[model samples]
Target: MIDAIMPDSVRTAGRALQVWDRWLLGCTFVLLALGVTMVYSASIAYAEREMQNSAYYLIRHVSFAILGLVLMVFVMHTRIRWWEKSGPFLLLLGIASLCLVLVPGINAHVNGSSRWIRLGIVNIQPSEFMKLFMVVYLAGYLVRKQEALRNFTQGIVMVSLVVAVIGTLLLLEPDMGTLVVMTVTVFAMLFLGGVRFWHFMLVLAVGLGGMAVLAVISPYRMGRVTSFLDPWADPFNSGFQLVQALIAFGRGELFGVGVGASVQKLFYLPAAHTDFVFAVLAEELGLMAVLGVIVLFGIIFARAFVIAHQAEAAGQLYSARLAQGLGLLFASQAMINMGVNMGLMPTKGLTLPFLSYGGSSLLASCMAMGLLLLIGREARAAAWGRT
Candidate 1:
């Protein structure tokens, strides 16, 4: 009835909306809903003890999820050309925010890191925005420098320098997790942009070597590395977090003890609702549920690559690179978060994309997913044009 009353153009767009990527959209919402449930479960005890409100974190997480969904819808409707054009500006804004967060008296210091700006009741983390903006900037750069990318001086060196600058700024915030994600995402984009294999390997070696040196120079990072190697060696101190995480997994066994039945979240596991939320999830929901979550992420990553390939095949280099970069960002972050939870990697302050309780990370992830959907829509339109 509404369609009958609407104009033909409106009806046409409604039909297009009906054909948007259902798999991507469906997986995103499922993870989001699951996240809300797990967050409430993981945070209720802590919230009650600290704030006298059992719904504190859950309320905030849901509010941010709603806001992120709105931003996602807006981005999905906006033209891809706008993002391509505004890429540089967004990058500059991200850099400026990073700088602002490091300034004394302006920055919000929390847990020994100056990585956020306090806004009344909320703390805004700039590094999260940096990941998305860096992807956008690099996507545009890859398109504009496609021809030059094969050359060391024009392509690899220039991009590396840009990444280095971003890394330096992030390290000042001391956000090693975001820096790792950003570096990997950019390198993946360059490789997909057809930089020579040897050049890619040389740059990768140098980047990894530099990170190793940074880790060695930092006492805390070195402790994390050593503790990760043998978490049981100092289980009470340096390895406390990882050891608790492993215990959550061990308790989970095949099936979870049941939702809200987790003992680990009772002040036993650090960051049970934030960085280690996945561990709490495993404890309450079990190995089966954890595997399901992993499969959902795998599907999202696979679909991203499929969309990227379609865009590339349709001759949309900008769209292709953007999709590729988003794929890398999501996949790498998810892997890192899960790895840390399962004790496969050293702990870092990275959130599970759609499943962790974080406003900035959720918003940035929704934006990335929205762009992927937009790219898929355009690819379909281009295909139809050829037909």
Candidate 2:
């Protein structure tokens, strides 16, 4: 047993594992910290004005972040197989919660939309959690049907039916923005899973047609479409918020007025703490800071794609597809929120990922990140055979 042979494979594998783990964990903490600081800065003015306590929103956000951090650690430490195995059950629970939010006396109606469940101190938006659950569920389903995925009938029918059913519920809430994002997430996953292109196109056409019909049937939606074209036309009415958002951005030049120094938060921007938080961010932090936010999200997208590539190379197709889909979901939502704030797109009540204020959004987004971390870890383990 004294051969003293060299094992180059083991030594090289160990180095690769170390590198992956370092990159993934470092990125996770950096993103979380950025979220906390930005959320606190973005919400302070609204909190002081509305609640008469500047620390109110900050404390709540910190508490939620702590809770989310715990959940993240739990997910990261847990077995990847567990998430894959439990995907179906979680999907069922998510669907049930989504249904419960629709039932009278059980749901909380905020601003004419019944999208939450009030449980005394906390109101939970099931849709936020539903997104992560759907991602996990679809990932598992696609992997299970990898062979059948090549078949037109089974693949399109099953996938299309799920999207249609979920799309109806979200549309009934009249959450057109979220419905569109969710449809994009599912189709993105399906495309990554090797579904035929023509089938996906058929689904897209139907979805676009449905959106057009909904716009006609709903007067408010039609108004939004009109406002999108020329918000200045109705400066004092339907377009007020859009015009105000533009003003906020214009006020903030290269360098912002400084943190907690946004003028728009003084009632100029409606939904200051929620949907339009990005405008407040721009007003306070300036255009440079706004660009920074975009860049940070860009880094996240790039890292996620790296994970996907690694996972695919390792032959873990489900993890790769799920990771990629989630990256798209998070990045796309952020862009949509920012675009709406900048008046580049029609406004819908979508929160900016990570930086927006909301308990459910915070918790659900953290959970998605947890799942993302798990995928990244699995990729590392697969590539280098390390735990």
Candidate 3:
């Protein structure tokens, strides 16, 4: 009816949006569908306990999913130039938001970490915004300073100083998890941008060593590291989360116990809807579902890199690096979340991209996907002489 009342040109423009990669879009929505199901299954009891309504969590999840979907569509149509031209502003915004989260009264603390700013209805997690903004800004930097990146003083040092400031603020929030993800993603982008191999390795080593030292010096981080190493030894206290995650995986030998049937999500597993959703998925849907989710993400990021390479072949260097960075960001975080669920790594607050139940994560992920689509479309258009 709205279309009927609107101008024909407007209707035509509305229908002009195209999907360059069906696999990317398909896999993402499939994960979102599964996420909706699992979030309800995992959060029903917890939400009831907290809100007296079983559908409380589910309602919020769906609401955010809808909002994210709209944002995804809107972003798909946004001019790619806007992203590049506004890179510096976005970076400033990211930095300011991160600093704001560290301020008293403005920042919201959940589970002891102040990583969010309450914005009336939704809590904004600046780190998520930082991830996307940093990628775009760094990609533009690579394009502008491609030649200078080979210099030891000009390339890595400058980048390191910038990230160090961001990293310090993150540590103040005590959100080491986001810091780790952001650090790895930034390095991956730098590597793709042709930062000297020796420089890359040297900085990587220093970064990892510094993170280790920070972890060792903090009692909270130390406890987590120790728990990850031997959760069984402290199963009742420090190791409880990992132990329960392991139990969920163990219970999911072949087929899952069936949706909503996992015993662990019944207060046995903490963060069943967020950090540990993959484990809850394993418990309910079993190995097949687990492999399926992995394959979906595999398709997503594999296509992402392909898009990056295609963009490169078409002489869009910034677009290429942006695609690579976004792909690596998704791939790295997904692997970490899954590894933590399987007890292969220390538990972190990382969400499994679209599969986890968080409004900020979902929206940010969808926006990333939109960027990927935009990049892919531009690549194909340039290849076909449309540019």
Each model's Cα RMSD: 2.9, 5.5, 3.5
lDDT of 1 by residue, 1-387 (tens): 323422112124345433367788879989999999999999999999999999999999999999998888788889889999999999999989998998888888878889998888888998998999999999999888878888997669988888888899989888999999899889988898889999999999999999999999999999999999999999999999999999999999889999999999999998899999999999988999999999989988898899989888898889989988998899999999999999999989999998999998999899989899889888777765675
C-alpha TM-scores of all predictions: 0.95, 0.91, 0.94
The per-model lDDT (C-alpha) reads 0.90, 0.78, 0.88
For model 2, name the residue pairs that clash.
none
lDDT of 2 by residue, 1-387 (tens): 111221112245335333224444555566566666666766677677779998887788778878986787677667667878898898889878888888999898898898888899888988888888888888888889988876777667787887777778887765777877787788878877888888878877887898889889999999998898899999889999999889989888888888778787777888877788778778877888889878877877787888889888998888887788778878878888888998888889888777777888878887777777778777776777633
In model 2, the runs with Cα more than 4 Å from the true position are 1-16, 19-31
Top candidate (TM-score): 1
Ranking by lDDT: 1, 3, 2
Greater-lDDT candidate between 1 and 2: 1
Residue-wise lDDT of candidate 3 within 333-386, one digit each (tens)?
899899999988887888999988998899999999989988988887677564
Sequence-dependent TM-score of model 2: 0.91
lDDT (Cα, 0-100) at 150 in candidate 3: 93
Instruction: Show model 1 residue runs off by greater than 4 Å.
Output: 1-18
Ordered from best to worst TM-score, the candidate numbers read 1, 3, 2
What is the TM-score (0 to 1) of candidate 1? 0.95
